[model samples]
Target: MRVLGVDPGLTRCGVGVIESGRAREIACLGVGVVRTPSTDELADRLMAVAEGVEGWMDAHRPEVVAVERVFSQQNVRTVMGTAQVSGIVALAAARRDLPVAFHTPSAVKAAISGSGRADKRQVTTMITKILGLESPPKPADAADALALAVCHLWRAPMSDRIAEAEAKAAQLARNHRARLADAARERGSTGGQQR
Candidate 1:
């Protein structure tokens, strides 16, 4: 599967694209940061970021998008900016009818580096090894974006199974509810007629 991963930030949102192959082979197609001028107004910065992300989506044409889930930070302004960029990524994906997956930083780190608490260097090193890259992907944000994509690729099969199970359970519950309603209706009709 081809996936686009996003590490969202107002000033420097990271975008990366990768493709998965047989036997867990993964290839990085592209990785980079999308920057917006901090001096610009919030609305303009958002627009720039949106356009930058859209450009990546257009260029890569990924089947799905994986975004870093915004976690609580001491800096509310920073968190807000991250959340807004993340939303832009989701909206852009939705416009193309693509599936979007949000994975937390800990989850991405764990998936790539085998530890939820792995630091950026560990993640970058592991990502380099996983992708067989000569060197680590530049910029922690870019590496993080790649990690998000990798995490989604790794998790997607299980997610699909879980979704299927949930759907089946929901259908069974609906069917059971319908049967109970039908039985109640039959009882109501028969009892009213007898009365």
Candidate 2:
């Protein structure tokens, strides 16, 4: 499948496009950041990001768009800005009706490095190795975006299976609990005792 991955930010959003399946391969369709001048108003910056993403979508026509999910941290302002950027990324995908998926940082790390706690450098190293590139993609952010796409390629199916399994297990647990409660009530009524 052809997938476009986006690492969204107001000042510099990273983008990467890759095609995979049938064979494990990738073409560096494009990689770069969307930059808006610092002097520009925040609203303008956001608009630029959205426009940039739209342009990429038009050019690449990816079947799916994978984006990193915004993580809330101690810095509320940063979190808010990241959330806005993520929203734009989602909107861009929605505009095209392309399938969109989100990957958490931990999921990306685990997919790339077999460990959720892997550091950025480790993730970068794995990406480079997987792509068989002599050097890492530029601007770190661009590399990260590529990594996110790769992570989704590897993890999306597994995640779906896990979610399905969990849902089934939860339903079973609920049914078992209800049966136990029903049995208890029946026993209480038959005994007709206040014990």
Winning candidate number (lDDT): 1
Quick one: how many clashes does candidate 1 have?
0
Per-candidate Cα lDDT values, in order, are 0.94, 0.85
Mind giving the per-residue lDDT tens digits that candidate 1 earns over 45-147?
Answer: 9999999999999998999999999987749989999999999889999999998999999999999989999999999999899888888898999999999
The TM-scores, one per candidate, come to 0.85, 0.79
Clashing pairs in 1: none
